[model samples]
Target: MDFCWSPTDPVIALFVPTDADEMQPARVSLIHVPNKEELKKKNLNGVRDCKMFWQSNGEYLAVLFNQFNGTRSTNYQRFAIFGIKDPGIPLEDFELENENDMIIAFSWEPKGQRFAVIHALDQRQNVSFYSVIKSHNRFQFSKLVTLEVEQAGSLHWSPAGRFILVAAMRGCGGDLIFYDVDALATLAIERFVATNIEWSPTGRYVATIRTLSDELDVRQEEFQEGVMIWSFFGVLLYQIPRRHFTQFWWRPRPSPSSCTQEMQDVLEVVNELDIDLDNDLDNVIFFGDVDNEDTSFHIIYRATFHLESTRGLGSVVDRDWTYDE
Candidate 1:
């Protein structure tokens, strides 16, 4: 089990299993990080494995749990939504179709109240989409779409929450299926046997790194590592082979304030000015004579002003241009 923290709040959700008593059921704990106070603890009787997910807007928290049925001997996939302001009351509790269905994959939208779940049922897998809704001061979950996939690996949502990537690793020789969330239709598919796939921070690109052997399994003896970077629209950006390639990461883009076109142009001008100033200062030092004993001395004063456009303030820089008799 893993813990998930709210994106815009100080709340976290985690699952705690029973220690020794067979009568005691597992509990999911919602805690406040700053004060370490548990806001709510909900009992899960037959939950074996679970995951915590928070909505990007920080309005709701979802807990996906796999419940074990000891009588019929099967797994049940269920999800529960809790209100952030009132953790004690559950907003919604939904169970997938068929109690024997197994939760193969699940993911939440990166920036919205929508989520997707893939489960195995009736000898095939189905993908279901659900979104949170509010009705008369209460929250409700509405099913958006349910599509069928042949063989799915994992679920990944785009940073912009516009598309979903369904990775197929085992059956189809490693393929990625992209789906449009708004249209609820298939967009594109790319076949690549990748051990890991990561989305760029800015949601512009995704990198798939090869770390597995031809059998689609990770092993130490496997060589001939490779990587493929692709755009969000399924365009192949770059591909290369590397030796002993363990990991690769995209540089996180700076905030909008530091990445605007105007800011970039200003930075370029400042860099050029700095280079020119350095050259001019070097020439001045080489031409100035320190050994001359002249009663009358000439002093050159140079001032560079730094303007903070956002704050409307200016500061001066001293470049060691003072001379005395």
Candidate 2:
């Protein structure tokens, strides 16, 4: 339930219990809110499929949906990026194409220059890239790449738009593939069972959550669902339970100007093996140099959506413990 705002308009996500239909009538709050906003029948028209991308500046959004007419056709091919000249009035809009199927995944190029779309077409999916180019006294889509993928379950773009991550479902034997967008070379391939995927902001790690374990049904054979943080080369770095797969956030490298020679020395002195990032130990980590006169310590901001709680052996057993008289 991630709520986002595009300039003036705030869009809240609506969930569907069945059919995987985005237009199942959900609510829209005035501003982007994480709380429950039930969709009345009137607001159903504004809700569209999952293929929605907010422009880089957050001034506009591109979405696809069906209209009010009784005679219906394919999903709305083109949608306007919601902008606002007046409060609550959806402003700037640009219609692109009539992509026949549902648009599931999309990426806006870094620096708001272009965007890419991935549409679900049954077992196969369509990958289309677009650039904003001058045409007819306005900008038109310059299709850069139009390709197809098999069993395409997920997609992601590198920060600089240099690559795209594709995950495919091939029954019990599926593959996770990475490709260089420009050179068009296969970067890496992996076989970790994944339910969801996200690339780190710095493009150094690809985080994936295994679906089977998240459901927590032991009777199900594939319930070892876990989260794996992998290097760009497909090497696993950190692994946790699916519930531990929280947000896809990366620590920004501190600028050289902000770091003193002492900070560098401290890092060099601390060996990786000596330091423990043990989740099982259940310790709260605070990363910063309070004594550094010129540096700012990074704050671990806990997202309100998933406020994590501490767990202990006693905490677990106490809840289920009982005394026999």
Where does candidate 2 stray beyond 4 Å? 1-4, 7-52, 68-70, 73-75, 81-99, 135-137, 168-174, 214-224, 227-229, 233-325
Model 1: residues >4 Å from true position, as ranges? 1-4, 34-36, 69-72, 85-89, 170-172, 213-224, 256-266, 269-325
Q: How many clashing pairs in candidate 2? A: 5
The superposed Cα distance between candidate 1 and the true structure at residue 81, in angstroms, equals 1.7
TM-score of each: 0.70, 0.52
lDDT of 1 by residue, 5-110 (tens): 8888888888887556547888888888889998877888887668877777777777888777777376677887787765344566877756678877778798
The superposed Cα distance between candidate 1 and the true structure at residue 181, in angstroms, equals 0.5
Across residues 1-325, which tens digit of lDDT does each residue of candidate 2 receive?
A: 2344554334443322213454455333234444444322124343344344566555445554443333454345545444422244343344445445666666676545567677765666667767666433344466777666654555666665667677753234456767666665667777645666766555666677665533332345644554566666666766655333333334344656897776564344333223331232112212122222321122223211011232212111111221221
Cα lDDT for residue 152, model 1?
78
Q: CA lDDT of 122 in candidate 2?
A: 61
Best by lDDT: 1
Residue pairs clashing in model 2 are 26-39, 27-39, 61-81, 61-82, 83-91
Residue 306 Cα positional deviation in candidate 1, in Å, after optimal superposition: 32
